[model samples]
Target: MALKITWRNILPGCFKAKSPTSPLEPRNQVSKTNSLQRLSLSDISNNGSFFSASDISNSLIGFGSNLHIFTLKELEMITQNFSSTNYLGEGGFGPVHKGFIDDKIRRGLEAQPVAVKLLDLDGSQGHKEWLAEVIFLGQLRHPHLVKLIGYCCEDEHRLLVYEYMARGNLENQLFRRYSITLPWLTRLKVAIGAAKGLAFLHGEEKPVIYRDFKASNILLDSDYTAKLSDFGLAKDGPEGDDTHVTTRVMGTRGYAAPEYIMTGHLTSKSDVYSFGVVLLELLTGRRTMDKNRPSREQSLVEWGRPLLKDPQKLDRIMDPRLEGQYSMEGARKAAVLAYQCLSHHPKSRPTMSNVVKALEPLLDLNDILAGSFIYMAPTEGKKDNDDVDIIGNEHEETEAEKNEHRNVSEEEEAEKKEHGRHQHRKGYRHKHRMRSFRSRAVYSDTALYRTYRTSFDNPKLQGQDIVN
Candidate 1:
C-alpha cells in the first residue's frame, strides 16, 4: 500500500519514491571547465531571448550548478499532489509547498526538507522573474543567501527548490498581530545578518542590484539568521565607468528609493534605501506602509525618518513594545545608520559593507536601559493614561494571524532569549509591578520577568528552549 505524506512527517526531511527527470534539453554546452560566470542582470534584462527557461540550462550550469533536474511527478509525490496541508504561503511568484528529498530519491542527495516555489501561470510575476531567480541563485552562493538546491522545467511548469527556512520570512514575524516583540538583540542580530547578505551581493566582482529587497523577501532560518531570498528582480551591476544601470522602476511601494522611482536609475544605493526602510521597520516595530493607519502616519519612512535623526525623539518612535528594555546607545547608533541609509541623495548613502559595519557593533550593545516597559492587558473599560498605553491599535488577530507562528521556535530558541531576559530583570526602574500581557495584573520583580517571557513566546517553547 502507498503511504500517505503530510506536513508533520515532512519535517526532519525524508524522500519519496524516485521518478524520471524532466525532458527539457540543454541547448548550450554548460562549461564547468570555465570559471563559474557571475550573471549580469542588466545583460539578462536587455536580451529577451536569453531569458527563456528551456534554453538557459547550459548557462546555469556554466554559472556553477550540477542542475539536478526533477520531474513534476517527483515533486507532486513528495508534496502529496501539492495538497493544501503542505502549502507554506504565497508570494508574487506563486504558492510554495514543503517537500522532502533523501538518498532514496538520489544517492548522495542529503536527507533534507525543501521549499518548492511553482510559478503561477496567471500570477503577477511570469517566466522572466522565474528565469531571473534561476540565473542569480544558481551561480551566486553565500551563507546569508537562500540556497537554490535545484529546479524543474517540464513543459510549461516552472518550479524552484530552495533549502527550507524553518522560521519563514521577517514580515510575518515583525508585523503579526499580538506577536511578542522580537528581542532587541535578536532584532539587531537579524539586521547584521541581512546586511551581510546584501554586502555579499553588492561586493560581488561585478555588483548585482537586488531590486527586490523587503521584509517578505528576507527569510529567517532556525537560528533567526536572515537570508535574502527571491531574486526575481535582480540585475547585474553596470560595467566600468557606468555610474548606474537604468532600468524600469520596479519594487515594493514604500521600500523603493525616491531617485530610482523617479528616474529609473538603479544602483546599489537603491537597495540601501530599501534596507533602511526594513531597518526602520525592525527598529520601530512598524510596517513600511499601512493603509489602515492615519493619512499622516501612513508612510513609515516619512514619519520615522525625521524621528530617526533626532535622538531626543528615539523613545517616541522606538518600538514601544520593547518597554524600555533595549539598549539606548545601540538604538541611537542604529537610528543614525537608518537616517544615513534613507538619505534622499544616493551618494550620501553608505554602501552595504558600511551598513554591515554600522550594525555589527550594535549587536554587542546589549545593555538594557534601567527602566520598565509595563504592558497592562487591555480591559473593555480601560482608559489611555500613564499606565494604559495602546500599541498600534491593539493588534486584532484573525484566524490566519493566530496560526502564523508555526515552525518559528528555532528562530526564538536559537536567539539566546533566556540570556536576554536574564539581563531584563537585572536592572529595572520599577521593581514591584507585574502585568499579564493577557487578562490579569500583578507586580513583582520575578513575576515581571516571567510575564515578559510568557507573553513573548505564544506557542513557542520557553525556559528550556533557549540555546546554550
Candidate 2:
C-alpha cells in the first residue's frame, strides 16, 4: 500500500493548510454558515490561534481558509525559482529574498513590486512565524508599518510577500560601515515613525501586541523613512481591559522586557521597554546588548540608564560620529524619554504617543541648533549641575581626540599593517602544521607495516628497521 502524507506533515513551518477552493473556485463547504458559529474570535484568541477543519469551512476576511494554495511553479515564478543571486538577508527564521512580481498582471494586485520571504525548510519552525506575520500585518494597517502584500501556501513551500523597503533595516543603517551617515534629523524621524507604529499596535481597537520590536525589525524605504517590520512574535492584546496578555514568552534576549522575562505575561509596556533600547542605540550608536563589555556594563539599558538621567552627562552617551552636531536640548529630551521607558515599573513608562511628542521637535531641531550647539552646551563650572559621575571615560582620549592630542600621523596605519602581517604569518605556520599531520600519519603507517612484516619474517629484524 502506498503511504499517504498530507501537506501539513510534510511542511514543517506553515501555520495552516490552504483550502481546496481557489480565487476562482466555487464556495462549497467553505461558505457554510453553520460552521461559522463555531469559529468564534474568542476561540481563535484562546487556543492554538489556528483554525480547525470546521472553521476552515467558514470564510476568513474574504477568502476560504483551507486552500491547498500555491503551485510550485507559481512560487518558482514569483521568487525567480529561489535563485541564490536574489537572496537578500538571513535570520533566525530563514533567508529573505528580493523578487520582482509584475503586479500589473495579478488579479488583486494594485500593480506594484513585491518581495517574497520563503521559509527555510531545513531547521526553522517558521510556519507559525509566517502565520503570525501574515495574520497580524494583513489585518493591521498603519502608515508606520510595512504592508503585507499576500502569502503563498503550496505543497511544503510556505512564503510571505511584503512591500519592499529600499533601505533595508535600521540596524544596517546605524552600524553598517557602507551605509550612508544618517543625519540627525533623519534618525529622529525614523525614531518617531517607529514610535507611531508601536503606539498604533498598543492602542488598537483590540490592541495588538508586537512582541518583537528591535532595530533590525525596523525597515527603511527609499527616502530613508522607517517602517515597522516582522510580526512573527505578535499576539492580539488582551480584550476587555485584561491589563496584560500572557503567553509562552518568545523574543530576542536583549530587547525583551525584564518583567516579561521573569513572568510569561506580556503587555504594551513590554514593547515600550524594547523601544527604549532602540532609542538608546539611535543616540549612542551602540548595540542594545553586548557580551564583550565588562559584566558591570554589558546590557546597554542598565549601563546607559544612569547616564540618561543627568543632562550634563548626556554628551558621553551621544554617538561620537555626530561630532557635536546634535542639539543638546533635543538629545537631553531623548535621553529622558529613554530613561522613562527603561523604568523598573512598566506603569511608569509613558505611552508611545508621549514618546512621539518628545521626539517630534527634534525633527527640525538638528539644523535649527546647527553649529549653535557650541553655545547650547553648558560651559565648564556651570552651577546647573548636581551629583554627576561625568559619564563615560571623560578623561580618556577619543580616537579622533587622541590623533589630534598626540599628533599621530600616517605612519600609524603602516605600522598596524606590518603588525597584522606578522600575526598572519604565525597563523599560516600553525595551519600548515595541522595540514601536514595526515602526511605524517601515512608515513608512520608505512613504517609500522614494514616493522610488522619484518617481525613476522625474522626475530632479529626489529633493531635493523628502527629509525630515529
Candidate 3:
C-alpha cells in the first residue's frame, strides 16, 4: 500500500503541536526552519534521492503544489542582481526590492511587477518567520489579504514574493508629513476592508489570531483598498473547550492587547484590540506612541479613550487635516466602536464580525446626513436657521441652539480653510521632504513614489507604505 501522509503527519510539531507544560515554564523556542529542514531530510529518505527537486516541491505542507518555488538564480535575475535602484523598504524581515517577471520564467503568467523580500540572515526575524509567512498566506486567500505570489528558498537564502501594492501601508498615509490626508469616506472604506480581513481570519474553520494588526501591517492597493500583510506573528487560536492559546508575548508595543501582553493569553479578542488602535489612528491621524509628543499624549489609547464618547471634544481629537468633511454622527458611532474594542476587559470587546457590521453603516453618506438632519431638526417652529443671528446682535438662542449653530459654522469655516490650504500646498510639492519616524524607517524610493504619484491616481489612493 502507498504510504499515506497528512499535513499533521508531515509536520508533526506544527503550530497546533502542544501547549506549554507549565504556565511558568518558557515555551519551546525550536525554530520552524529547523523543523522543516528535518522534514525535508525525511522526505529525501523516503524518495531515495537527496535534494531531488520534485520530491522537495511535493514535501511542503499545503503549499507543495499551490505556490511557485523559485530558484535563487531566478529571483536574482528578476531583481536585476539585487540592485539598489530596485530597493523598496526594510522591515524586521529585511530589505525588500521591486522586481518584474515575464512569461519566460513563469509560463502562462503575464509580465507583471512584484515585490521581493529577502530575509536578513542577521535581522531580528529569522527563517522561522519567513516560513510562517508562507504557511499562513499560502493557505489563506481573501480580497483584503495581501497576495503572496511565490517564495525563494535555496541554500541559506530565504525570500518571499508578493503582489505590488501601489499605495503601500496605512502607517505612512496617516502619520507621514505632507502625505495626502485620507478623507473621512476613504478612511471608513479602508477600515471596513481591513475589518473584513480580520473577521475572516477569526471566523475560519480553525480561527487565526493576527498577532500583529498595526497600521504598518495594513497595506493599501492602487484603489486604496486595505489589505492585511506580514503574518510572521500570526498564531492558531484555541481549540475545543480551550478559551485561549498561551504563547510567549510578541507584537508591537502600543498595538498589543493588554490582556495578551499581561498574561500571554492569545485569543481572537486580542486582534480586535489591536484593530481598535488602528481605527483610532485613522480617526485622529496620530501615531500610537510618539516620544516627540507630550508625555501624557504618547499613549493614544489612554489619552483618547475618554474623549471618544464626548461629542464636544470630538473635533479636538479628530485629525485636523480632515477639515470637517466627515459626518458627526458617523464619527460618533465609530468612536463608540473604538471605545468598546479598547475596553480593559477582553470579553467586553466586540468580535471582528460585529466590528465590520458597525462600520458598514458609517460609510453611508445619506444615512449620516439623514441622522444629522434629524438630530438638528428645529423644535416648536423655531427654524434651524433662526438660531444664528447674522447681524452680529446677541440674541439668546437656547444653549442647544447656540451650540448647534457654532458647530455648523465651524465645519463651514474648516472647509473653506482646507480649500485654501490645498491651493497653497500645490506650490510647495517640489520642496517636500519626508519626515521619518523612529519607530519605522521610511525608504527614500517609496517616499519619492508617494510624492510623485500623489496626483496620478485617484487622490484617495496615493498615500501609505507598500511591503514586500
Say which candidate scores most in TM-score. 1
Q: How do these models rank on lDDT, best leading?
A: 1, 3, 2
Clash counts per candidate, in order, are 5, 7, 4
On TM-score, who's better, 2 or 3? 3
What is candidate 1's lDDT per residue for 347-444, written digit by digit as tens? 99999999998888776774765444433333445554433433333444344433333223344465446445332222334322222222223333
Q: Is 1 or 2 the stronger prediction by lDDT? A: 1
lDDT values, one for every candidate: 0.71, 0.63, 0.69
Worst 10 residues of 1 by lDDT: 459-468
TM-score of 1: 0.73
- Work out the TM-score per prediction: 0.73, 0.67, 0.69
TM-score, model 2 to reference: 0.67
Cα lDDT of model 2 by residue, 143-256, tens digit: 899988667776567777788776678887777653334556667878999999999887876677787888888887766577988787787777685988768877776788
lDDT for each residue of candidate 3 in 1-468, tens digit (9 for 90 to 100) = 222223332222222433323422111112223224323211212231112222223444333325676777899999998898887677777888888988788786668888888999987678667767876786677899998888877667888989888776777766767655776777888899999999998987667888889887888787779999888878878768999998888888788888888889889999999999999998898888877889899899988999998876776687776545466778888999999999989999999999999999886644222101112334456665564332224334566666666776677577667666342121121111111110112223233345546542211212122121
Which candidate has the highest lDDT of all? 1
TM-score of 3: 0.69
Q: What is the full ranking by TM-score, best candidate first? A: 1, 3, 2
